[model samples]
Target: MNPRLPEFQTATATDEQKTILNEILSGPRGNLNGPFLGWIFSPQLAQHAQRLGAFCRYQTGLPLRLSELAILVTAARWRAQAEWHIHYPIAMQAGLPADIAEAIRVGAEPTFAEQDEALIYAFATELYETKRVSDATYQQAVGRFGHTVVVNLVGLLGYYALVAMTLNVFDMRADGQNSLPFAE
Candidate 1:
């Protein structure tokens, strides 16, 4: 699928856009792609979102496995193919079981070996489906991960939701993968 908007043209970038672009390029992302392609049209939003994303993706207290699980849940909830395609490998590398990921892709209940994975999956899915978590789930997450990580988890979910929206709206799919994780 083609993107709804043209990719950002560095040659025609405004000073503000250029600065933000440079920051993004120099940051952990190291490239202009994904939602960055859509966000460059609004440099201010791009700047703030990218900074927040940096925190959510890298600086969050949640361990890589937990963080990736939450991200995959968000991608599945939103049916954001690009988000799924990009993070699936990262999640696998972090030791998230392929069976679990495959379950999420197909909207089945994943049987998790680790208690933490089960907890995260429950928290994320509850929050997305019901718009709020039950007290048991909330207490479990806070007890397991602490207040700071719980907060970061929420922020991470919100940020990824924004990414999913951007990708879905602009049709910014991952390159080199043709099969859709979700049926259209």
Candidate 2:
């Protein structure tokens, strides 16, 4: 687990919130201080992470729905409150149902309208349960999403899994200033 803040904590951000602040203001966020933060602070993880963002955003073309689904599952599987807390609203903004996001926060089976969401949840569950997905599930995903999306979905799971673990390992918490799922 790495230290939460990089030395220059924001004026409004508390030390408690610094855990979450590290993620929001620095590291990945725009208001960065140090040369590297979050993934950048970790050179080894950065190589894989940079490629992962590209893979999820470009290679997959998964859109926000499936991407959010992949992220939420990774958060829940790892009990990562911070990741779940932030992505909860982002997922809804991406068009996922509020009910589904809430269910995911507390570790419940999520209902879905998008076929890709269901498939992603299934894949995440399978991976968490057995450490590997079955051939039938893989085939179904490939058939439904095509090979490129399937590949990126896998990447999404892996990338978000890294995020969840990183947050958890560092005891990261949410910045409380964030709004709820449907907040305007």
Candidate 3:
């Protein structure tokens, strides 16, 4: 699918949009892509989303590997091509097992080497596939990570899901990529 909005450019932006865009550009992401391109149409929403995304991707209580795993689950579930293209490598760099990542990419169950990875996989997949996690899964996560981390995990899931939805709705895609790994 084609992009619904044009790519953001400083010269064409209003002062407020430029300010927000510059702020995003200077941050860890370094450049805007994916849903941000479409979100820039609403500067306030873009700013707010970027901030939330930063927290989910960087500051969440879960480790980077776990967070990236959850993000991959969301991306695959949504068949979000751009999101998968962006986060798959990041997840690998963060130490998510290649086989596990590949399994998720292909819509198969992954064998996790770490218990934390397994729990996160179960939690994320249950949340996405069933729309709710079972009591056992909830308690297990809470027992291991505590309430705050669990809350952050949920927040991460919700935030990325929003991003995936935005990208899908806009039909945003990575340049030069032919198709996403998973089939609908």
Candidate 4:
């Protein structure tokens, strides 16, 4: 798919844009791609989003594995090819089961071996599919991970959903690969 926006170039960037790009480059992400490329159109928004995303992806209360699982679920729910491609390997590196990530990529319900993974999958899937999570699922998440983690989980979901929407709206392709595993 062709991108609706042009790629950001540092050579032509204004001072403010250069600052924002510098901030992103210095962060843990090191370099920008995917949604960040689109975000450069609004430097301030990109700055704030980068901070929030850093927290969600790195500092959230949930383990990296569970957080990546939630992200995978969000990517699958939105069929965000860029997101899936970017995070699939990270999810695997974080120790998420390969079969589970592949299942989510293919739009199948993954059978999770870990209870925490199962809970996160259920929570994210229920929210994405129905726009609301059942009380039982909510309570299970809260009981297991506490309210702070639950709040972070919801924030993570909403944040990634926004990223997915941006990637889809602008037709961002991951690493020049245009195919998505799941059907629209």
Give the CA lDDT, 0 to 100, for residue 107 in model 4.
80
What lDDT would candidate 4 get against the real structure? 0.88
- TM-score attained by model 3: 0.93
Model 4 RMSD in Å is 1.5
User: Which of 2 and 4 is ahead in TM-score?
Assistant: 4
Ranking by TM-score: 1, 4, 3, 2
Cα TM-score per model: 0.96, 0.72, 0.93, 0.94
- Per TM-score, the best of the predicted structures is 1
Q: Where does model 1 exceed 4 Å of error?
A: none
The sequence of per-residue lDDT tens digits that candidate 4 reaches over residues 1-184 is 6678987788889888888888888999897876888888998888888889988988779999999999999998898988998898899999999999988888878897799999999999899889899999999999999999899999999999989999999988777665676665
lDDT of 1 by residue, 1-184 (tens): 8779986678999999999989999999897656887898998999999999999999889889989999999999999988998899999999999999999988999998999999999999999999999999999999998999899999999999999999999888886768788877
Model 1 clashing-pair count:
0
Model 2 over residues 1-184: C-alpha lDDT tens digits? 2357464434754454454434434433444321224555454455455546545644577777778777888777777666777777778888888888778777778887877778888987898889999999999888887888777787878777777676656555566623322221
The C-alpha lDDT values of all candidates are 0.91, 0.67, 0.88, 0.88
Over all chains combined, what TM-score does candidate 2 have? 0.72
Better model by lDDT: candidate 1 vs candidate 2: 1
Total clashes in model 4, counting residue pairs 3 or more apart in sequence or in different chains: 0
By lDDT, the better pick of 1 and 3 is 1
The all-Cα superposition gives candidate 1 an RMSD in Å to the true structure of 1.1
With a 3 Å backbone cut-off (N, CA, C), the pairs that clash in candidate 3 are none
User: What's the distance in Å from true for residue 133, model 1?
Assistant: 0.8
